[model samples]
Target chain A: MKEIALHMLDIAENSLDAGATKVELLLELTTGGMLEFSILDNGKGMDDETLKMTSDPFFTSRTTRRVGMGIPLLRQHAELAGGGLKTRSEKGKGTELKAVFVAGHPDIQPLGDIEGCWMMLAAMHNDVNIELRCSTPKGDFEISSELARQELEVEHLNESALRTELKRLIRNNLAAIGFTDGKIDKTILNS
Target chain B: MEKIRSLADLKKIRDENNKGVELRKKGEDADKLVQVKVAMATCGIASGAKETMEFLADSLEKRGVEAVVTQTGCMGYCYAEPTIEVTLPGRDPIVFGNVNVKKADEIIEKYIKGGELVDGIIPVNYETIDSKE
Candidate 1:
């Protein structure tokens, strides 16, 4: 919630909740000079009604709180940065959410350390198949848990120091996006 | 700044950074790390996954377990919001539903370091259908 990575993370969490086994999470510098981030999931997509209602801060199907606000927050962030967010979904097919942040826009927030994103993700959804890709004007990087397992000869990437490796992968992606100085706060990592 | 075109480059840099920490090189067993998965999906949050994850992270630090607490997508058992799964060394992972700080404490005390399973267990069914199939 405090960073763009947190919002991307929240959306990814939602995608996973939609029964997605394979989620393609992408962040790229689009040709339009905007930083575009998208999460495509093979989950149970929402109906048109829900998609239309998602932007409304008060419309949530969940019986939790009277105010539903994640989507609204994402939309506000995008608009404030001179870009926009869009979501498309089909009932039984899947869902795709794209959020664009204007390139060099003064209002655009910096992309936070992705290692935190990846660590939280690895430690969070060990069961789901998550593929995260990020590209920038300088370089690009990708992490596929399925592929990592096949290459590393391991079952999962969540435990032990393997998580550290995942953290490194995330750090590299952030560096590619010009977030070189960002390191996993050792206190958070050890915690 | 060289280009990072593949996973290999990523790994090289990753290993280089590992120099600062005592990385247990790839083939060694990771038996002591306590792995806790926090369900942070919309349903999970509606049920308080954020608070649960924070509590676990904070409490684990206090206990010196060196655990990694993270948020995850939903496990489809909406009835069981705020679900958590704990994986200890050499043991089958256990899933607990309706998890809160109290349950988290029990998990840290009984399951994480104590090796005892508490209530609210949600048996995992890996055979569930994926629409792609």
Candidate 2:
């Protein structure tokens, strides 16, 4: 939860737990220093009550433990960093989570280990497909697991060599888009 | 972003792929390979489990160890975040706690490769469904 990217990973995991077959993650940094992070999932959408209750740290439908802190913590982080979070869902449809933060806010956390996040998502969920798109003023990049699998001729994304190739592609592309060295300000927003 | 046609080509970009997405499928037989399960729940991640898992996968691959690395939910040990269970073929699984990158490397070298138990072994206080009893 220290990094906004960690929040992104946590929110995406929630989608996977909800039985989502397809998940889309979008990260955009605007010229005005606003970083928008969004995840769209085709899982079993929450009902009105569940949607309302998700903002509360103590309210979790999971029986494994009593508390679920992903959503609440993300909300807290976003708000504290001079931004906010919004969620929309409908029963039997899907859910979308969007959070925005100020890129240069002193309290804003670093974008922790996004490559690790994407790799975990791809490797852990072979059946589920994920599409990640990151955009900045410098450039934009998109990676789709389905496309990578097709091109690499691998049955699963977790194949050692293929996974390595996919990770390389993502990192190279992100670097091209100026997301290098984990510093988003000088590379993307300020530049 | 070139196409990988051979193993050498794959090796050329291995470090760039440090995420190590070598996830194992459920119900797959672990009889012939070392089985590693990384705890990736909220607590585990907050404590840097992702980096440890990545290191395990990369180091094992580099050392030519045949292993299946996968992620699992909480093992009810939040106090010991970033835990891992290593099960050699035909042996009882050993749970290691607080496994950072260094500890993971040591586990791979001393215990996994040398067959000598290392530090960080967590005693089993509760029985799981697959426990041998």
Candidate 3:
């Protein structure tokens, strides 16, 4: 939870565990002086009971354990930065989680290793259709795992060479959008 | 590697490169092949589970083994930050704890390949609500 990117990976994993075939990770680099992001999936959504306890660190749906801190931790991360988190889910529908972080807040965590997060998400799950969309004042750049697979003609995106290539591609594209090195550049605010 | 500004650019380089690696045949439950579920809760991530996961996925593919590597929530093994459950075709799942990249490699070579049980097996004797009769 130290890095916001790790939080993204955690939530994406939750979507996969929920049997989500389509996972979308959206990032708005700087909005109203805040960093906003969301992970949406068409997986098995939570019921009212489960949704109510989502922010409770001890309330977990997993039978193997009793504690689940993913959501709680993300909420805390957002709050620490003078932002907040929102969750909306319906039974048998899907889950949508949005988190915000104040851009200038001193306690804001760095957006660590987003490239690794995206790379792992795309590489690890070849069957799942994952997409990454980063929106900044400059413009929006999107990376669809399906599109990438189609372009590369690679069945499984787990190829090490391709992983490196995709990671580089993500880094470069994100950089072009003024989000680089796990933190947004100052130019983004002016633009 | 040239600059990959877009997917098109990426495709241009590997234009002729197509083939190699098979996840599973069409219409077959890929889980019937090899299923790896990695614990990826906060504790797991703090303990470098991400690295282990990437290693497992990469090595499994590189070895030509058709496996589906997925991430699961906490398995109540906070002490063992990085834990993984491996299920072979038609076999019960086995949970391994304190798994680093090296242990992951060993598990891949001996357990997954040789069908021999590896060390660090965390005995699973409890039942989940889904399993309760």
Candidate 4:
């Protein structure tokens, strides 16, 4: 699980470097007892040969770097957790990354603070469109940038204040939806 | 154990608990709630969404914002990572990206609390035909 999220961080970084303008994130916990994580992006997707080679530990597209282990790490973690990772991409359309974790697996960690995940994205990529959604047995939750910009009254909403407020909102929403058993102690991050 | 049959039963249990003291009853309308969305899309994570998300959740809890933080699949743009969206009651949701730990702190300090826009502003370029303007 640790490596799964870490792989997520890595692939997403690749997309960012590709000059993507929007990214979509989805986590679906199906009634069939499957936990799935998929990231889709409009950045320059990989070619067919590269896609096939990404899983190989020794294969990497980086010309300057000798070793690229992100994809291999993802494969290792997913398989260790009794899950698997799949990637599909086109040169222009985009790429899709999916990983599935079996329910009740001891290795699969609970999806951590996802709301905070988006906040982190906002802090890093301030100029891109981002949409995130999660669906579970309980219900569904969604967040979008275009939606927030339209609801405000200020002529120009302050980005810094918006970030803080978004964090607060995500925490509350997660609690409301039972994303976590209880509120995460806020003191940990700031201190 | 017998299943909980109604809202009243849930409330009764809440009333009996010490952990949730003075807590508002569930099943009530979420009229005044705040909703925060984290873009865990590939682009977002590559830009350090993981650390940023952790920071925000920890920070928000410290602030007692009564909010929810979660990871989302993606929104299509790959350049701006670690993206996030904020939604307050009766308001539109806001999205931001290109985040790091320091940016997360600034976000918590300025955007979340003060309702302000910060440095990272992703320019939306993709468009669909006959859209709502």
Which residue runs of candidate 4 sit more than 4 Å off their true CA positions?
A1-6, A153-160, A181-191, B1-133
Model 3, residue pairs in steric clash: none
Error of 3 at A110 (Å): 1.8
* Model 1 regions lying over 4 Å from their true place: A181-191, B1-6, B9-133
TM-score of 2: 0.85
User: Which ten residues in a row are the worst by lDDT in model 1 chain B?
Assistant: B21-30
User: Tens-digit lDDT track for model 4 on A1-191?
Assistant: 24343554566666666677888877776666666888888998879998898788677554422355667766666676689999999998788888887745677655665655565554455466666676666556676544443343222222344555665665555554445532222232123
* Full-model lDDT for every candidate: 0.69, 0.77, 0.82, 0.61
In candidate 2, stretches whose alpha carbon ends up further than 4 angstroms from where it belongs are A159-161, B1-28, B126-133
Q: TM-score of chain A, model 4?
A: 0.80
Ten residues in a row with the worst lDDT in model 2 chain A?
Answer: A146-155
- CA-based DockQ, model 4: 0.04
Model 2: which docking level applies?
incorrect
| CA error at residue A13 for candidate 2, angstroms | 1.5
In candidate 2, what are the lDDT values of residues A53-140, reduced to their tens digit?
Answer: 9999888765545567888888889899899999999877899999999987888877766666887787777688887888888777
Candidate number of the best DockQ: 3
TM-score of chain A of 2: 0.93
Off by over 4 Å in 3: A47-49, A186-191, B1-5, B19-36, B60-70, B86-94, B102-119, B123-133
Error of 3 at A54 (Å): 0.8
Top-scoring candidate (lDDT) = 3
Native contacts retained, all candidates in order: 0.17, 0.10, 0.33, 0.04
The sequence of per-residue lDDT tens digits that candidate 3 reaches over residues A33-91 is 88898999999999878888989998876776667888898999899999999999987
Report the C-alpha lDDT of model 1 over A61-99, residue by residue, as the tens digit.
554345556788888989998999999999889999999
